[model samples]
Target: MSVNNKTVWLTGASSGIGLALARQLANQGARLILTSRREQQLEELRQSLPNSEQHQVLALDLNQPEKAKETASAALKNTPVDILINNAGVSQRSPAMETDLTVYRTLMEVDYFSVVALNQVVLADMVKRRNGHIVTVSSVAGKVGTKLRSGYSGAKFAVIGYMDCLRAEMAEHNVRCTTVLPGFVHTQIAHNALTGDGSLRGKEDQDNASGISPEQCAADIIRAIESNKAEVISGKGMSKVAPLLQRFFPGLLRKMLANR
Candidate 1:
């Protein structure tokens, strides 16, 4: 689908990939509804994009998915969202044994449930119109498991399953569901990752430090959406090849992960 003139509702738009995507979509002539908990940052980002005044800002916490679902769905009921990008999420940096149950719950709520909720809000409209795209930002972790990401990977993996099913269902409706599995992008995700105790890690991972730029990731994602690709992977490190390896060399991949 052409991004030009499309009304894209983007979450997590205050920073990182979402921020970069907002800029690119605006430059491509799309109107946007930028969402994030940081109202000030969202407004600032909206203004910096092209056709700034034409965009909308609706700051809401995805952590509170119920409220977000209600508010966002309400906003779109009359707005006709041509695209919905489920990019709002949190991350984790702890193993299953060490991570608190609450931490896992938080990850599931923010990373999995919230994406479903927001997508549900937009699905009806898209199905009715029979012309819309839903791009969800999962992670390369979704395709493979590793250390320090049990909860995060679990949620991401769930997203893959959910979006895969959605893609199949939406195909007949002429609605596209493209799941993007990005690896470690150079974003604050690592620094903001939840630890074992459900507290922020507040430190950057070496993987993220060396990962692809958010702008680059966003561009790739935009291309995937435009092409209606079912799935696309981005970023650096083993993320690029882990899925292939897992499929062809499961035991080797497991052994390699164990050593990491």
Candidate 2:
């Protein structure tokens, strides 16, 4: 299950964990198909990598879920995809009561439906080949709901459930599925997070600012993929403990989150 020489289609490649994962995967001799809304940034990233000529870029907005199938077809036209990384997602920092329904719909479209749409396209090919991997970047919020992240958490939770079912279904096809639950890596996610009115928060959260580096998170994710793991949780401190607390001590975890 080494990714060496494997062709990986990675989304959200312009920044944050996606960017770090691209660098690490490139170093492993994996040919990448990088996608994001920023074509210029994707080109810059490609030029910065070793063997830059070996990689490809396909810029598109995942917000438009209807286009994902077409995008996936174009991506696979050049190379048979050995792995598909569903990492493009949006975050939210608003209470459920105040947030507009459109905001929740937008988040679900980008974070959940888009992944499913893209996967539906690529997965058929993988089943035909009987060899491929689907890696999704979920969140700790998917495991434990928290304040100010209702929409974001709901979307992530859907991802977890979908991936779980996908893993079971793909098991017979020998196509691996790995769900990555990252706590909080130091990235632009918080700054780009949507507010109640669907406007960007434009301010980084203190917790995210003090979180683990994206490089470290990328390394952990790569390792998980290589190991053919079903799931991997990456983060530090309470982020690592929150899931456990929620599973074993729900009452205590609920009280703690309530007081936060």
Cα miss at 203, model 1 (Å)?
A: 1.3
Residue-level lDDT for 187 in candidate 2? 98
- Model 1 clashing residue pairs (backbone): none
What TM-score does candidate 1 get on C-alpha atoms? 0.98
Best by lDDT: 2
For candidate 1, lDDT tens digit of each residue in 13-51? Answer: 987899899989999999999998999999889888888
Question: What is the TM-score of each predicted model, taking all chains together?
Answer: 0.98, 0.98
Question: What lDDT, from 0 to 1, does candidate 1 have?
Answer: 0.90
Q: How far is candidate 2 from the true structure (C-alpha RMSD, Å)?
A: 0.9
